[model samples]
Target: MKEFDLIKQYFAQRGHVRKDVILGIGDDCAITKVPDNQHLAVTTDTLISGVHFLADAPARSVAYKAVAVNLSDLAACGAEPAWISLSLSLPSYDEAWIDEFVNGLYELTEYYSVQLIGGDTVTGPLALTITAQGFVPPDTELRRSNAKPGDWIYVTGNLGDAGAGLDILKGNIEASAEHRDYLINRHYYPTPRVLAGTSLRRTANTGIDVSDGLVADLSHILRASGCGATVHVDRLPVSSALFDTVGAQQAYRYALSAGDDYELVFTVNEEQRGNLETSLANANVKATCIGQVNGYTGQLDLRLYDAKYELDKDAGYEHQF
Candidate 1:
């Protein structure tokens, strides 16, 4: 199929329809309205085959992950997702693959009530880029620079499961069938904490989504806020599947350094601690208090029951470029 034909058949007029989108697909530029008194939050992410996902991974999963990761960025800013534009590059046209990919993309956009705006399709290496836009109330957006000393650090949902799942897919680890399926699904379908992030706008002093490992993402908050943190290593949340398959030491290492979990890591000061619990409860999201911010700027201290704990290697994912 030709480029425009492919877009019309699989992408245009598909997915959730948002009223805020004045002009979506088939337009020179997407025209969207920002609600009065709200600010626009925009994020873009690119996923390349073999680099971001396994080259042989399902097209559906690749599409879903592309949308999820960008939405996770908006969630960290406490924005309500409203629209997305996709730029897809494929080595060649594959009808069945495109069908499944559109299904996956629409599945997530529908769940989040996001509309597809506009974008381009090009012939190139397999890669997908999504630019997601959302709305956030002015002065209420969560930011990494807002954290303060004495604030308690909290993370929503378990960590390390996705990393473990990647290892299993790579044949670097083994697990029982049931556990294997669970871990693999965790890797493919990471839940972006949209509801939890919105709830945190009023209570959280600062916030970030755990795209990188917990330690790596938290370091961003520390640096941005000009503060440090003391994380209780034992308090890091690990899924039963990961713990069972990888033992305590390996599980802890994954929790500390592995990426792609997409959970939210936020901070709440003592004054807002009670309200934090209530806010999260209202959203029906569970969060664990894993550490506290400190005065030492840009420092991350990992402690296991009051004893210093150290990782054997560098923590978190980093691109060589």
Candidate 2:
């Protein structure tokens, strides 16, 4: 199939259709409308075969993850997702693979009411890049630079499951049948906390989605906010699947440094603590207080029930180049 034919057959008219998209697909450019009094939030992510996922991973999973990671970035900014443009590079035109991938991509876009406006397709190494755009009310967007000293640090949902799941896929760890499926599913489908993030805009001083592990991502907040934090290692949330499969010590390590859990980590001050709880409860999202921001600028202190804890390896994933 020709590139334009492939786009028309699989993508041009697929997924949720948003009214704000004035012109989508078949055009040189997509024109979208931003609602008055709101700001647009944009994020782009690229996933390469063998680097982001196993080359033989399911096409559905690859497509789902590609969209989810970008949505997670918008969620961190407390934006409501509205549109996406997908650029897909494939080694060959495998119609069956494209079908599965489009199904997975539309599943998420439909759920979030995101429109696939336009993009490009080409023959090359397997890779996918998605540029996702969303909206947030002016002055209400969540940011890493807004955290203040004495604010309580909190994270939505459990951590470390995705990291452990990757290990299982790479044959570096073993789990029982039940635990294995659960962990692998977590790795394949990460939930971006859209509602929770929007709710936090009214309460959280700052926030970030946990993509590159808790320690690494939180350090971004510290550096941006010019504040230090004291995180209680015992407070880091670990799922039953991760803890049961890897034991306490290894689970804690994964929670701290293994990365790829797309849950939100946010900070809320004492004055808004009550409101934070109420807001998240209303959003039907679970969150835990892991620590507090401190006066020491650009420092992160990890404590295990009052004793100092240190990471024995690199904090999180970083591109070598």
* TM values, all candidates: 0.98, 0.97
Residue 219 lDDT (model 1): 94
Winning candidate number (lDDT): 2
RMSD of 2: 1.4
**Per-residue lDDT of model 1, residues 96-161, tens digit only:** 999989888888999999898989999999998999999899898999999999999999999999
Clashes of each: 0, 0
Q: What is the lDDT of residue 37 in candidate 1?
A: 91
lDDT of 2 by residue, 143-225 (tens): 99999999999999999999889889889999999999999989888888888888988788998999998999999999999
Model 1 residue-pair collision total: 0
Positional deviation of residue 117's Cα in model 1 after best superposition, in angstroms: 0.8
Model 2 TM = 0.97
Model 2, global lDDT: 0.91
